[model samples]
Target chain A: MDVYLPVAEMAVSPWLMIGLGFFVGAMSGVFGVGGGFLMTPLLMLLGIPAPTAVVAGANVAAAAATTSVLGHFERRGVDLRMGLVVSIGGVVGVSVGALLFAAMKAVGADEGLVRVAYVGLLGFVGFSITREAWQALARTRRGEEPAGGRVRNDLAHRLPWKVRFPRSRLYISVIPPLAIGFCVGVLSAIMGVGGGFLLIPLLIYVLHLPPSLVVGTSTFQVLVMASTTTFLQGSANGGLDLFLSGLLIGGAVVGAQIGIVIGRRMKGEQIRMVFGLLVLLVALRLAADLVLEPALMFSASPPGAGL
Target chain B: MTGLFRIILAVLACALAWVGAPARAQNRGRSAAGIDEAVLVTSSFNGARVTIFGTAPTSPSDLDVVVLVRGPDRPAWIGERQRFFGLWLGQKRLRFDAAPTYFGVASAKPLGQVAAPDTLALYGLTPESQLAVQAGDTGMEPEERDRLMREYARLRAREGLYVADAAGVQRLPGGLFRADLQMPDTTAPGLYTAKVMVFRNGRQLDSTLMTLVVSKIGLERVLYRFARNSPALHALLGVALALGAGFVASRVLRRVSVT
Candidate 1:
């Protein structure tokens, strides 16, 4: 049955949207990452207009993260100092990213450039995580200790203004997290994603944050960024449909609760492996879309055309 | 007296002869020509005017096309005078008109001359009588279909609803029928069928029916399908998947611990 959304002026099947929310929320809960990488594409497949889908997904993510963060706080899993520092960086990154997005649109290269970048970045992340997980699994079978991956001396770590995070016991300069946050924010704006998937890994490997704090911190930033995105998209584009967001968030919140409980029971490596596989799947799908023949190549006018 | 009687008798005979000749001629014409393929076009939506288009053999001085639409229940239309009063009363009395169960449009053109741009809007059909036209599902005959189309067209025109041009209607060069229809924004989302009837010389000749579907997209539409079918099962499965990944991650990290 179809339910009519008064604000959006659309009729939608409540059941379908809730299911999508459950799936994405589960992924987010399990991986300690934003499910934007999956949710945005999934929505597009369901024939939602791109702009609305992006804004709605971000809104739902914010609500879900807010609910999930409570559990993290209860467990004392959050590193407030790290989280705050990262958020500051993220806010700057978002501004930069938003500017870049506008520039890309002005130059008419937004679609092609964003697609290429998305596929490339997702593919890299997916392969690296999957490879690490697979090797670790093989080592366990042989009764050997897993390899401890170290951060390389990269430009990201060399930046100035380094701050120490006592909870994670990392003494690195605060600039790395800030830079990472900024980069993720920019990507979020460009790709219409929360950038949690990317941020978690960067925190763990590049910034040398403990794995326990990665998910919590990422979720924290996601909550803030997504909330901001919702407001901005709503006011700027008039694309945020509160009715749609409410439905998706309702299902997502429930799903996230279940996800968090399950996440607590599982081992850290297992979460990483699963997250890797999921990211790989998404990356492969996007890559295939780019390389393969499109089913339909027509570009029609956006909805509400011709007045 | 005889001369007057003769005159009267002759006048009566002439009048009788004139009437009798036409009847015979009509019978002969039917046998010789058979039924002509007449075309009628119409478009409409609920709570709107119905636009009628068709060709007829004779242009009648007065023509009336009747259209009928049936659909989901809806609101009523307040007359213009009431609307003005409503503004001052501070009581926005939203009149509830029933869903249009039937609508129609009629014109005075003969069956042969009906062409593009010569449209008639039938405003008599009430929303209570309007019915939605389910195009593919309704197993209506050709005549019934035509009638439905006329009804839908008239209703749509009256309501100021926009409809794509009909494919079934053959538009002559530079000749087309255009009519504005108004539809209440609150019309139910569903498949609706329309019927159109054409009248010439106060007689119904041909009618047709067409179908239209309305839909919307929202969060409920996007996620509810997966959630409803297997909410608990999916939740459990997701947990299982997460657990399985966690196990793998743990083993991997333990192995990496040595390196």
Candidate 2:
């Protein structure tokens, strides 16, 4: 059935939207990340306006995060303390990012900047993950400790304001995670992403937290970040559409549950490999958009439709 | 007897002119057309096919009918993406002083075949003719502007906001015909003008104008107004609902899937 979206002022097939939500939700559950990166592009591909796509992505991420976090808790591993600290920084980042979004809109640079950043970020993240996964696979075949089996020395280890997280059995500075969280928060707000893909890598590599604790902590933090963004973007820019969000959330919640069960059956190496490739595909699509000439030269947008 | 007949004929002609003068002056040389609805209140509007019925004074077979529906105009900007520092970003741009939010035109035959380009432009039946470019003379020649305007029209057509459907008007058995134009759900709400024109041998003969309103109503109206008028409240409500939806999803999933 077709449903009317009040904010977007369009009628869309509800089933199609639900199916998209399910697919993104499954990816989120398996990766223990908010699936906004995937959701936004897919929605745009389906012809939903960019503003509506971005806001709806955040809304779905919120619901998916909640579902994923609970699953992590049930499995009996998550660092609540670390999650809280990161969330605090994330809140600040979202506020700053929201302000920047508004300022950019005023200068007529918001959407252009957002698309460019999306391409750069996705490309970098995608290539790096695929490489990491391939190396890990080789190590396992040679009967050695898999690559990234242990956290490497990075700037996070050298940071000040050290704190202890007992659950992860790590003594690291609070500044690293907080700073990382802050950066991710700003980018996520601007790009309408959950920052989970970016966050999980940081938690695992930079913080060197236990693998079991990483997903839980990331999901918990994403929940807060996404919620903050959803409200800030809507209130500040009026980008959100309740009907679109509701359709997505309904399917994502169920899909996340199924994904949790399936993820448990898959190897970590395999999951990372697939996730990396998916990210790379999105990146390539964005690059292609830049390189190719558009069908029409001139375009027109309605007044007061900026941002 | 011949003289008496001539006087009677003169008097009859004067009476006919007196009666027709008021009616012709009132219409201002406009043809007659009636729209299905005068006010389109959009509640859960999924788009409506506006059926316009009209009759031309000439034989319907010999005349061509065109219907043009246009919404309120607003300013806009169109930017071109270019390579800058190894990154693709927006560069050169064209601004529009006035661009319609929605524009749809339908005719019995192709607009070009029914009327001359100049005639179409004068009547504002083509999308390219409707645009008022902001960069009217920014080192751009007349030909360049014409090409750019054509591109702009194509772009709008791709977005489904501006369309020119050739088979939009249908001929009827009598000297009457109907034109049906389907507005998508994304149609903007505002004051819209529906124009019906009659053409003979690539020249416009007569035209009529009918104004219809597309306005938000019921719950949709209230919500749209709230978002526009009280953005703070709208944002708060959006966030609260998001949080609530999260909470609800978790609770519901725990019962069914999470074991």
Per TM-score, the best of the predicted structures is: 2
lDDT of each: 0.55, 0.74
Best by lDDT: 2
Interface RMSD of 1: 23.8
lDDT of 1 by residue, B1-259 (tens): 0111121101100000001111234322221111121111111111223233333222232333333333334332221111122221111111222434222222223223443222332322333124333444246565644454454444444433423332323322322222222233323444444444444443344444454434333443343333335444423332233333333433443355447
Instruction: Compute the DockQ of candidate 2.
Output: 0.24
Model 2's number of clashes is 0
Interface RMSD of every predicted model, in angstroms: 23.8, 13.6
Model 2: per-residue Cα lDDT at residue B82: 64
TM-score of chain B of 1: 0.30
Q: Candidate 2's C-alpha lDDT?
A: 0.74
- Candidate 1: list runs displaced more than 4 Å: A149-160, A305-307, B1-259
| Whole-model lDDT, model 1 | 0.55
Candidate 2: list runs displaced more than 4 Å: A99-117, A146-158, A292-307, B1-27, B30-45, B59-64, B83-88, B135-142, B171-174, B199-206, B257-259
